[model samples]
Target: MNLFELVEQLFEQYGYLVLLIGLPLDFIALPIPPGNSTLTYTGFLTYKGIVEMVPAFGSAFIGAAIGLTITYILGYKLGMPLIERYGKWLFIKPSLVEKTQVYYNKYGNKLLIICFFIPGVRQFIGCFIGMIRVPYRTVWIYGYTGVAAWVISFFSIGYIFGEQWQYILNVVEHYLKVIFICLACSFLILLVWNRVKREKAKKLSNATRNE
Candidate 1:
């Protein structure tokens, strides 16, 4: 059967447990039924009263956290040795890891906030951050924030649109990356502008004090 059909059946049979298990699996790149569709479908189920909204969100968030922690721990404990030993089988290469390192270096931890919105990046992000030795505290803060945003966005779509959820999801998937990039740029610009304004104010205050 198709993924959508599979997800529907799973949800029908298991309810909130589907999200509890499925989301974590997705984070580890298993994606048995896929994250986006699964989340949206969960929202739909909530709307239909097949599952309670609070528990559904809880299941999704906790599941994602578990998955992220698992992958991060794997990367942290094993480091490059694990990758070198099994990279070929997983299609992961040292070169790919090096490139990810460069990207992480350039972007810093802020990437964790938006990585889930991006496709392939989300699957490997926890491990990548751990491999590069970013502290778990930083990952926990930014990564969990991203997880909440991701779950809310897709789930709300399903809840809000009802029968139109699938159509809306298709459109969103097409433009998700571009939309997030624009938002990230705008946030950075605002941060820079605020910093400049603060610095100027500090300088003016110092000059007045000297006078």
Candidate 2:
């Protein structure tokens, strides 16, 4: 069966436990159900009264935290050796890790919050953070909150849309591409604007000195 069908079967049989277990596994990059679709489906169930809302949300949040924590710890304990040995399989190069570390260092833990929203990014971010030795407290504060917000948002969409919840998956997938494009354009604009400002300032300074 397809992933959504499999997820539906699991949830129908196991309910909250499935979410509690499944979410973390997905976060850890397991080839299980997609986390977003699962969470949204749970929310739809909650609206139908098949599952309680609080427990569903709580289970998802906890599952995500547990999964991320495990990955982070693994990254911390194993360090570069693990990456060097198996990173190629995951397509993670040492150069990419170095670049991620540099960006994380410059931007601080806020990137951890933003990473959760990016598909294919959330899976690796925890490991990278842990490998870089970010404080556990910082990870808990930023990482957990981000996961919580992400879970709640998607779940809420499912709950609000009720029987139409399936549409959310398509909407999310489409919007994500649009959001990424917008972000890229914004970043480029800011970079060019900053360069132009600096050049203007330098030219003005030179003119003053010459006068």
TM-score of each: 0.74, 0.76
Worst 10 residues of 2 by lDDT: 99-108
Question: Who wins the TM-score comparison?
Answer: 2
> Which lDDT values do the candidates have, in the order given?
0.82, 0.81
lDDT per residue for candidate 2 within 1-211, as digits (tens), equals 9876676678778877887788778778872777878888888888888778888899899888888898899888886887789989999887767865765677757767867776777787777788878889999899998898889888998899998888877787688778767866875686588679999999999999999
* Candidate 1 lDDT over residue span 1-211, tens digit each: 9876677788778877888888888988988777888889888878888778898889988888888888888878887887888989999887777765775667767768777877666788888788877787888788888888888998999889988999999899889777767866976696688679999999999999999
Checking candidate 2 for backbone clashes, the offending pairs are none
lDDT of 2 at 102: 68
RMSD to native, candidate 1: 8.7
Where does candidate 1 stray beyond 4 Å?
A: 83-106, 177-211
